[model samples]
Target: MTFLTLLLQTPAAGGGFLQFLFPVAIGLVLYFFMIRPQQRKTAEAKSFRESLVKGTRVVTIGGLHGLLVEVGPETVLLEVERGQRLRFDRNAVARVAGNPAAEGATPTPNA
Candidate 1:
């Protein structure tokens, strides 16, 4: 059929550049909207883990909340209950227990 023949025909000369441009534009959109934000969030989490200090209240990725008794290079000792402590990896911390102001707050009140 004539319609089939027309559909099989190659695109116009000037349309070649447009074909490549569409995929490149899509790549840029994906990088900015998806990949870039994830990278930034990961960096922030890493920095927070590195800067952790003793006496800070924190929650782990497993939803366990505790007061940081000791912060080592790659591990942290958490006082989950009075006279009861557990050790976990630095990366296990999800975030500070409360707000920014609670960073240095007394652990007993929050824990």
Candidate 2:
């Protein structure tokens, strides 16, 4: 067969296995690189939310920064200004102040 004709011809064997393996490899790559890191971030955020306590300074997902005045089971009260408090759902908290890792910084071994 001419070089051009040989190049155009499909593989006669192992093509099906190669096709299956390609997609499986792609899935594993996506899971490890994308999905797994996202899951870890979500778990860390949830843990941070659950561990909140009064007197912790936090920033909300909406960019509102305040001191946590009260941490309730389903919500938290934030003191934005002197005598000015706002109540928000617990999930609204994005990260605690002074924690670079929680604010999307590269996580360290001690973080």
Candidate 3:
């Protein structure tokens, strides 16, 4: 009876209640700062991959640079080495290299 009362009144050694709570607090902190942000970034990347279209210049996750020649439902055709085409999943594109359509404004060929 006395042991039960002591056990209820006091936590065991090694910081008792605080020890149990510490790991949980750390986990929550990691989730908020690390895990949650990573999940959000992954979702954003997925959305970006879904929204990609043909004729867009893009960089691959493997550092291959190319222009998006065709966009399929799940894959894409990339013109990497000037007339050399390669295929990859849409999600394999790390980022758009540059908007070629937006850079058509040239300051005269003479300049």
Worst 10 residues of 1 by lDDT: 102-111
When summed lDDT is taken over every stretch of 10 residues in candidate 2, the lowest stretch is: 98-107
Against the true structure, what is every candidate's RMSD? 5.7, 7.6, 7.2
Model 1 accuracy (lDDT, Cα):
0.90
Error of 1 at 38 (Å): 0.6
Question: Each model's C-alpha lDDT?
Answer: 0.90, 0.89, 0.88
lDDT of 2 by residue, 1-111 (tens): 699898789577666889899999999999999999999999998898899999998999999988899999999999986779999999999988775346556668885
Give candidate 2 misplaced runs (Cα > 4 Å): 1-14, 99-111
* Model 3 vs. true fold: TM: 0.67
Q: Model 1 clash tally?
A: 0
Clash pairs for candidate 2: none
* Candidate 1 wrong stretches, greater than 4 Å: 1-14, 99-111
Native-vs-model 2 lDDT? 0.89
Best by TM-score: 1
Note the residue pairs that clash in candidate 1: none
Better of 1 and 3 by lDDT: 1
